[model samples]
Target: MSKANRTLKKIKHQGGRIVPHLILITYMVIALFPILLILINSFKNRASIFNSPFSLPNAETFSLVGFETVFGRADFERYFLNSSIVTLASLLFTLLIGAAAAYALTEYKFKGSTFLSIYMAIGIMIPIRLGTVGILQLMVRFGLVNQLLSLILVYVAMNLPMTIFILSNFFQQVPVELKSAARLDGASEYQIFGLVIPLVRPALGAIGIFTMIPIWNDLWFPLILAPGTKTATITLGVQQFLGQFVSDWNAVLASLTMAMVPILILYLFFSKQMVRSITAGAIK
Candidate 1:
């Protein structure tokens, strides 16, 4: 109403905005600083790494020796391929199986459905690593102890509980009428699932992004279950490389930078969908 009041309100609103922006910038710096430091040092020589670690790579300090050393010592291509296979396979089975389990539990009234849901959900609370001894023994018995398939199976099992929990909530929000209408028109359960699965692509994508990270970054299972050079994921490969080349600063930093870049690119591409779907799923 008055100029003074309007000015005061504008100042208050601007002040409110400043606090959040400052907090966000602080968090961004906290998160990205290590990655930036790694990238910068990855380009510099060992002497520069210690003396000018904060400075950007310059003509005098810049080098690719680390990358060269990395390529020389490790079969990164094989490691990448192994990681890609395990991650993608685990993602595919986890989503499909989790979706089906979620659908059955939420849409059906069969006996023990509640108990089964609780049983599956128990995995979410318990870390899968706790059962590593039993898992390793079982895999050995099945002759899958040192194979990529073991990693895929273990990752899928580890991720499935959270996947089912997220999807079951989203499935509950899908109108019952949609399924009824499809059934009335002669669609079978399989067809209904086929149609419904696509409809929840956003939510699935969100969960996929969430599920894929830990699997990709996991070093424990890969180290224990599939530590062979041919079976090592990128994370395990990097760790092993670092162990042998601990004195090689450039290679160590380069290896870390390489490992971080792919995931960063992936998150940037899918982040919008992931955030939107997560919010929508939560609201539903």
Candidate 2:
């Protein structure tokens, strides 16, 4: 009887675990099904796309016409280059400046430091898009309306508040003794920062991924600020292409796939770092 009871309990425990796994698997499928459909249809002919949209590509249905159309119809390569430049430049500026500001707020004592921190933190509650009109007017005043530089600056400003907040939290967790010891060893503040940065690198990796995605996927600023210029980013270009190729199903799917693949690859690469940092934090 005890043996049977033990077996029943083990079964119940396993069943409980399996239920959550099943739920997670279901969510994963739901999330991925649309992307899978797009990728599957991207390689299919227009007839196949409409006729068997849910089916996988076969020998008779496989086509590269969509990709060819996208290339021929859009300056897709330039759009990608513009996006890459803006995302990378903005990411660099946000991390470097935000990290320094965070470290300063966490480390130094100054008049109005607390108020200044609060002032910066307020940007988190406010969406930068809310100031689009003012930003556009400011850009026009400086003749930066259609420039990639303007896009980069806007992204940097948009991402800075959150970056500083996250990095400041991490900086606070750094051992004051380490900084004190370094200072005792005649290390200047810059030297201490250099030492601390590598220790917080995993957190930095997490922030980089967080900051890059929004900037990469953003359509509003790019559309409003850099429309019609060669500085148009991939998201804006894809939107324009979709509008132009409304009936061209294959071209639309191909352009989407092109735009998605890079960001997907980047996310997958950094996701590990993000997960690791979170896990490490929990452990600590």
lDDT of 1 by residue, 1-284 (tens): 99999999999999999999999999999998988999999989999999989999989999999999888888898999999999999999999899999988888889999899999999999999999999999999999978999999999999989999988887887888999999999999989888788877777888888888889999999999999998999999988988998988889998888888898999899888878876776676
Which ten contiguous residues of candidate 1 have the minimum total lDDT?
A: 275-284
Angstrom error of the Cα, residue 203, model 2: value is 1.6
lDDT tens readout by residue for model 2, 147-250: 99999999889888998888898998899999999999999999999999998787788888778888889999999999974888999999988998998889
TM-score computed on alpha carbons, candidate 2: 0.91
Model 1: runs farther than 4 Å from truth? 1-20
Each model's number of backbone clashes?
0, 0
TM-score of each: 0.91, 0.91
Collision pairs in model 2 = none
- How much lDDT does candidate 1 score? 0.91
